[model samples]
Target: MSETSPAQRRPSGELEASVLAALWAADGPLSPAEVQSALGGRLARTTVTTILTRLHDKGAASRSRAGRGFAYSPIQDSAGLTARRMRSELDKQDDRNTALARFVSQLTSEDEQLLRTLLDAADDTPQRPGTGPQAAP
Candidate 1:
């Protein structure tokens, strides 16, 4: 068999993840060429474009006219995206309460304290209409 190319050997979604990291690090929207450059040119310009288009389609990114092509920006910053991913995984659980209990049980003391502090602060904060964690679904 022919030797597998590094590109072919790359794990599924790795390229898209790298592309998303580049987008997240960027101060503003980036074109495919810029994204490719940001990734140290490991990916082809076409590949970056494909990832950006996929992100846009999935609502993880937004794009706008930048000359003949589009410039893309992540819809959420890194923290928001991480939280969204956590929520997505949590939503997939058949035993959500058990999953949450296990998750909380594994937290380090500091992390648990921080979570509590955040929760306390959130509770103390006034909620605006249709906003905040306390808002009705």
Candidate 2:
């Protein structure tokens, strides 16, 4: 059998990221065929469908029935996606304190300051609706 060309081979992680990017770029939910088209038609409809399904399972995307197929949309913006990725990685560590300490040690001074300010602001924020005690009807 002939070997796959470099252009024909992409890491599964990269393909998943590309699929998510396509969904995020769309103004509304897109069927797998639309997602394939958005990615320049390089991927098959089945592949796009599988990727979208996996993303939906991972909470990165949501899907709703459309015609005989399903339309997919990103559940979060890019920043939210990045945060989810970071949290997922952090969750994998058995030594979370050590991991966090090492991560903090690598931060740039500016980033360190920004993180401190953000944490401070978060501490001052009121509990969001439905999270705190609810008023009696």
Candidate 3:
């Protein structure tokens, strides 16, 4: 079996993610059929609607009345969705040690070193009063 499941392999529900990305990239909400067509015939309008409904249930999409149909848009952008997905994955693994071990084992040498450096830098830096960096004065 592949280490990554299909759920993880794909960015999100293939049709759902694509439709949400399209809506996010667009100026406004899109109808289900419009989203299906935007995906280049890979999925049906009904499937798109199902995906949209699922996203709505998950709080990742919001639907607004548009004529007889509903227009849908993403609640979060691509990066936000990705972070949520990663967090979901990590959350599923209850053991902190196991999670860390899995993450470390997955990283390449360069990435591991980069993580080490970043962790070390964070440890060395002291937090100041304000959120932004201290003034040069």
The prediction achieving the highest TM-score against the true structure is 2
Model 3, TM vs. native? 0.64
The per-model lDDT (C-alpha) reads 0.89, 0.90, 0.81
For candidate 3, lDDT tens digit of each residue in 1-137?
55356777765556666778777877878898888777776676777898888988887889999998899988888889887977888888879788989889999999999989988898688877664346445
Give the top-scoring candidate (lDDT): 2
Candidate 3, after superposition: displacement of residue 85 in Å? 0.8
Cα lDDT tens digits, model 2, 85-116, are: 99999999999999999999999999999999
- CA error at residue 92 for candidate 2, angstroms: 2.7
- Residue runs of model 3 more than 4 Å from their true location after superposition: 1-12, 113-137
- Mind giving the per-residue lDDT tens digits that candidate 1 earns over 8-69? 79788787889999998999999999999999987778778888999899778999999999
> Looking at candidate 1, what is the lDDT of residue 120?
96
Candidate 2, poorest ten consecutive residues by summed lDDT = 128-137
TM-score of 1: 0.79
Per-residue error (Å), model 2, residue 91: 2.3
Task: Give the Cα-based TM-score of candidate 2 against the true structure.
Answer: 0.83
